[model samples]
Each structure stands twice: as C-alpha cells, then as structure tokens.
Target: MGEENNQTVVTEFIILGFPSLKKLYPLLFLLFLLIYVFTITGNIIIFTTVLTNYKLQIPMFYFLNHLSAMEIWYTSVIVPKMLSSFVSENKSISFSSCMVQLYLFSSLGASECYLLTAMAYDRYLAICQPLHYSSKMTNLTSHQLASGSWVGGFLSPVLPVVLISKLLFCGPNQVNYFYCDAQPLLKLACSSTQFTETAITTLATGLIFSSFLLTVLSYIFIISTILGIPSITGRNKAFSTCAAHLIVVMIYYGTITAMYMQPMSRFSLDINKVLSLLYTVVTPMLNPIIYSLRNNEMKHSLTKFFKQIDKRKN
Candidate 1:
C-alpha cells in the first residue's frame, strides 16, 4: 500500500503571521484595524467623489475612479484575513480559500499596474499632445482603456494560480507571511517549483517593468513639455497636475519592485513584513490623501460632498 503510506496532502495552512510580535497582538490588531478603516473610507470617498462631482467627469478622474475601486478590492483581499489572524487563536486558512485569496489579490494588484499606466498615458496626452487630447481621450476611449486594464489584470495571473493550485503540498503547511503570496506558496510545494517560480518572475517583470517604463516615458515627455512653457504660472500649473500621480507612482512601484524583483533570500522576514504592511495597508490610505491634498479640484469636490451630507443631516 505505497499509495496509502504516502504523506497525506495538506488541506489547510497555518499562517504564522508576524510571530515575532506575538507579545504585541493587541497593538498590532489595533494598528491594522485603524489602517483598514482609513483605507476603506478613503477609497470610498474618492470613488464617490469621482462619480458624483460633475466637474470631475474627465479622463483623469475616470482612471482615478478605477484606481480607487481597485485599492478597495486589493486591500480587502488581504487585510481582513490578516486582521483575523492577529486576533484569532487559529490562524489557519483552507486550501480553497487560500487559492481564492491568491487569485483575487494578484488580479487586483495587476489591474492597478495597468490602470496606473493608463493614467500616466492620459496625463501624457493632456499635457504633451494637447492638440488632439480631446479627440484622443473621448468618453468612449476612456471607457475602453479602463475596461482593458481590469480585464487584462484579471487574466494576467490566471496561468500561475492554476498551475500553483495543482501542486501537492505534502508537509510544513505553516506559511511564514501573513498571506498566501507566490513565493511563500512555492516554498511549501512538495514538487519542484522551478518552473512556477520562473513563470511568476517573467510575468511579474512584464507587468511591473512595462508599466513603470511607460509611466516613466510619459513623464519624460511631460517634463519636457512643462519646461518649454516660459510662463512661471503655466509651468507650475502643469507640474501640479502630475505631482500627486508621480508621488503615488513612486511609493507604489518603489516598494513593489524592491519586494518582488529580488531573490527570496533577500526578503528578510522583518523587512518583508514591513514592506507588506506598507504595500497592502499604508499605500491605499496614502493615495487618497495625496490625491486630495495635492489636487485643489478634488479638495473642492470633497468639500461639496461633505456639505451635502451636512445639509441632509439638518
């Protein structure tokens, strides 16, 4: 009975989520709870603002509307479970649930990459190619670009998730990270994971590298245009249009590149934990703040939104 004697396939994984901070569960729970609240509330505000504000019915806000929606989904896929693990005695997730988390998390993340690239391209057209900007970025075209980003992102991680899901996990079902990431899952597989790892690397590189490259190229053209404007006020206005976007792009891509580009060994547990927190939790909250703080139009719309609520309350 060789088949009967083989190790039983693992069906659940104990997420050893930030075990070093075991003594600080309360503090960590409270911290993550606050992060979750802020992230959800902030993104909801941005989404609602774009939808209701008539003045914001433009290409830039169209992309931002999608980004806000993505941030909500992206963070929800990870943080809710992470928060549960912090408070629960049993931090185990079922095999099926873990795979679902993996797919949705990867899908939303990939979608954001393409969505950000689309936003950069929109800014590039509006600033650099101003003559054809209105024609090129029509409502129909914006709708198509947004649709493509979501569809493409949802499809990008399909092969990897399917292949990885088929792997038999024989032993050591304790995941070191808070969530089911590709590297951690690969580390737990009983069979060879070289092909899976290679595939993940290539796909990740294509999404991350290509998106960053396009955004950077767009910025280069953008900066060139801004410099050619001789008027001080015009230059300031042009740069201000992109300042929020550039800040968000830097923070998001910088953390992501550092986390995924390097070897597994490079991801020290503490550093990886911190980076994961930043990417999954902090960035979502920060993006809305950056957009509203740096954008006068967003601020005004937000003001109008709150005033409307106040009027209804009275």
Candidate 2:
C-alpha cells in the first residue's frame, strides 16, 4: 500500500534518448527509420522465402524461419518507440506503458537466447549426427522446440517485471535509455532496489551463461566432427553449413554478455546505449544478410522470390 502510494509521485518517465544528440534528432530519426524499414523488410523476406521454398524445408532452415520471425517481433518492440522518441517532442512513457515495454523487450530477448540455443542444437545434430538428424528433429519436434523457446522467453521476464512494477518510483522520472530498459528503470526506484537488482542479475546470468554454454558445446562437437572428415572439400563443406550461425552466436553473445554480465556503473550511459543498439538494432538487420550471403540455398530462394515478384509485375 505504501509502495503504491509512493509510486503516485511519478506517473510517467521521460525517456532521455541521447540528450547529447539533441541537435541531430532529425538526422538520427531518418537513419533509424531507414534501418527499421530495412530490418522489417529483410526479416519478412527471409521468413516468406523459407516458408514458400520447398528445398529450404530442412530442420536448419526451419529454425531459421522461426528465428527470422522472432527477430521481426524483437526489433519491432524497441525500434519503433525509439524512432518516436527521436521525432516527437513528448518523450514520455506512462508507468504502465514502461512496464509493458520492459516485459516485451526482455521476453523477446530471452526468447532469442533460447531460440539461438535451439538453432545451435539443430546444427549440431545435422553436422555431428547426420543419420539420426532426420529421425530426431522431426516436424513435430522442431515445432515443439521453436514453441518451447517462445514460451520460455515470455515466461522468463514475468517475475522480474512484476517485481519492478512494485518498486516505489517517488521522484526523478527520467530513464536514461532510449527504451524502458530494466537497469535504467531500476535506477529510478526510491525503495531499496538491492533485492531486485540481485534477482535480475542472477536470472540474467543463469539464462545467458547456460544458453551460451550449450551453444559452445554444440559448436565444439560440430568442430570436432568436421575436423575428423578426411577430404578437405568435405570438411570445408561441413564447416560452411554452420558458419553463419556460429558468427551470429558469437556476435549476439558477445555484446549481450558484455552489457549485462557486469555492473552498469562499469560502463558509461553512452557506452551502454551503444552496446544496447548492437543487439537490438544492428543484429536484427544483420541476420538475413548473414544467412542469405553465407548459404547458397538461401541466396537461391531469395533470387527466386524476387523473380516471382518481377513476373507478377510483368
């Protein structure tokens, strides 16, 4: 009751999005708008291409399709609001709105972590155990795995967001982030945030490290299997299959771990913002390009997709 009463002191938060870039709002708006359009368009293309193409119906591409879909939602949660902050004079988000945003963004992030781990496992099966891959990663199994990731992702952030909502925000309603991020929001709470901070850190660390460990283990077996193949061309072909996913894993895990594993005070607000952008804005944009450029089948499907559109126009 007291917490609720104290919360009434600050009803909304001012999202101080790059206050240092105040003069360049228009240019930043245009840049982020272009990136946002490209991200949505790119992921949609990947999702549609994987769905329509008969040849790309294997387990690996199946997971990629789910990944593209998730990325679309993940980026959508953050980027659009960020674009609004750039253009609109009113940079405020209501208390309820902020909590909702935090829940969605964190949920999608957790979902991506699980989804990436699942993708790694799929690649491991395909590369390390080709014979059993078909039987083990059946249509039903793939759907379950994909569905499980989404379920896990959404459920992971519920407790954290609930705890945050109960925190007493008595004053200083400014969030020094482009979005309603957990760390920045926690900073504004007037009540004792030690327990909440510890809970977040523990949950985040467990989730991130466990998923990262599984991915690394999968890659280890994958690499060992590839190295044992006698022919150079055969080994190269095997390596090529999982390379894009591995690169993405490294990039995704790298930025997120650096940002979340340590105390926020270790990095300046500007640094934190930049790190957040890498995972939130830049990674989604890079996903389709990485997959399309690295995989021949994806490239072929993309070409066919565009050609079909051209034919329709003619």
Candidate 3:
C-alpha cells in the first residue's frame, strides 16, 4: 500500500533518538561516530584478510568473512542514521525511508542469526566429527549455507514490512526510539495492531529462537565432544576454536532476546534503546575482535596481512 492514503494521515515519523541525552549530543555523536568508523574498519580488515590470506582459507574463516561483510552492511543500515539524529535536528524519516530501514535492519539481523548457526554447525563438525569435517563442509556446502542464510533472512522480513506498511497512522508520527522498529511503530498506529503485533512477534520468535536452539544444540555437542578428548591440550585447542563464536552468540542473543523477544511496549523507551545499541552498535564492533583475539590463526593472518601491506608501500 502507498504511504499516503485516506485512512493514514501521517506520512512521516520523527525518530526521537535518545532524547534523554539531548544535552550531550556532541559527545554522543563523537562517540558513536568513532564506533561507526571502528566497526566498519575492523570488519573490513577481517573480510579482506580472510579473503586474501591463503592460510586462512578454511570453512571457519570463510564464514567469518561473510559475517564481516554482513557487519559492514548491518551497521551501515542503522548507525549513519543514528549519527544524523545525534548531529542534525532533523530526525524525521519519510514513511518509505522508514520501511526500507526497518526491512534492511531486520533482514541483516536475521541473516546473522542463520549465519551464526551455520558457523556453529561448522565448528561442531570440525570438533565432533573430525573424520568427516572436510567432506561435510566442502566449499560448495559452505556456499549453500551462507547463501541460504542471506536469502532466508532477507525473505523473513517481507511479510512484516508489508503488513506494517498497510497500517493506518492518523495522528502520532513520533517514534520514541532510535529506529523505525516494529514495536514502536505499532504503538503509534491508528488502527488496531493486534494482528500485526502477533504476526511480528510470532515470526521473530520462530526466526530468532529456532536459530538460537540450533546453535545451542550444536555447541552442546561440541562441548561434550571437547570434554571427551583424552588430552588437555587437545581439549583446549578444540575449545579455543569455537569459544569466541560462543561468546558472540551469547551477547547477540542476549541483547536481541531482551529487546525483541518480549512485549517491548511495556519497557522503558530508554531501556529499549540501550538494548538496541548492544546489538546494533556494540556487537558488530566486538565481533571481529572476539574472533581475531581468540584465534591464533586469525591473528597470524592479520599480522601477515599488515606486513604485506607495508611491504607493498615500501
């Protein structure tokens, strides 16, 4: 449906991003601006390093490469707009722009869920089914899993966006949050949002929790297998491979569950914004660090990558 129709009077929305911190706009802007740059730069480094370094061309790094690229797109979707709200007074977003933002944000979030699951499963095979790791996680298989993740994630948000777009918003155009989130938009709907809310919640639960369940199950097996290893060094090595990913999963799901899994309308708007920041801003920056810091191979690759760059300049 078109944004402007007889039933819907409000064609745009004012995103009241962190209104409680309005007095500290300059500090917040500078802070998140630095974060945005770091997030983009860090993920780019990971992506480029994984792609070029021959020794890092394995299934784990392959997935990490895709994840780094996604993080770039993911942060690009929301952070720039957030910075705008911090710097400029014009916090208004057109209806179409809002929907597009919501769609992209949700799609990338969903893709990450599936991508993380794929990574977990890859770790599972590497540790638990070592005999079959190579055959099971072939290049083609990795390609399929990663492509499926992106496809499924992008498709998951289509119905919700379409339904929300059709909702009537007669009076309030003020979205009391950082982004064009479904819950906040629903709160401002002129029409009854019972069905829309139910639909979005149901889809989110299935999408988010199911991926969580799969990832957990894979890790459970991986942990059990690690414990069964006869040598302490072997167990440590096995655990190290997946430890960073496990921490990342916990933080990602923890924040997402807190924000989107419940009735967010009942929560304080500031709390909601904080929860949003954990995943949208903080997690992306931390991911590459977690992976590179924990994985010796990744660190070696990164060091080699920089040395090569310096050599080229010299």
Candidate 3's TM-score? 0.96
Each prediction's total of clashing residue pairs, residues at least 3 apart in sequence or on different chains, is 0, 0, 0
What does candidate 2's lDDT look like per residue over 1-314, in tens digits? 76566455789999999999899999999998999899999999999999999999887898998889888998999988899998888999999999999999999899999999999999999999999999999999999999999999999999999999998888899999999988898888988888888888889889999999999999999999999999999998998899999989999999999888876456777888999999999999999999999888898889999999999999
Residue runs of model 3 more than 4 Å from their true location after superposition: 1-8
TM-score per model over all chains: 0.97, 0.97, 0.96
Q: Lowest-lDDT window of 10 residues in candidate 3?
A: 1-10
Q: Top lDDT: which candidate number?
A: 3
lDDT of each: 0.91, 0.91, 0.92
Clashing pairs in 2: none
Candidate 1, residues 49-112: lDDT per residue as tens digits?
9999889999999899999999999999999999998889989999999999999999998888
Model 1 scores worst on lDDT over the 10 consecutive residues at: 261-270
Error of 3 at 115 (Å): 0.5
2 or 3, greater by lDDT: 3
lDDT of 3 by residue, 11-65 (tens): 8999998887899999999999999999999999999999988888998999999
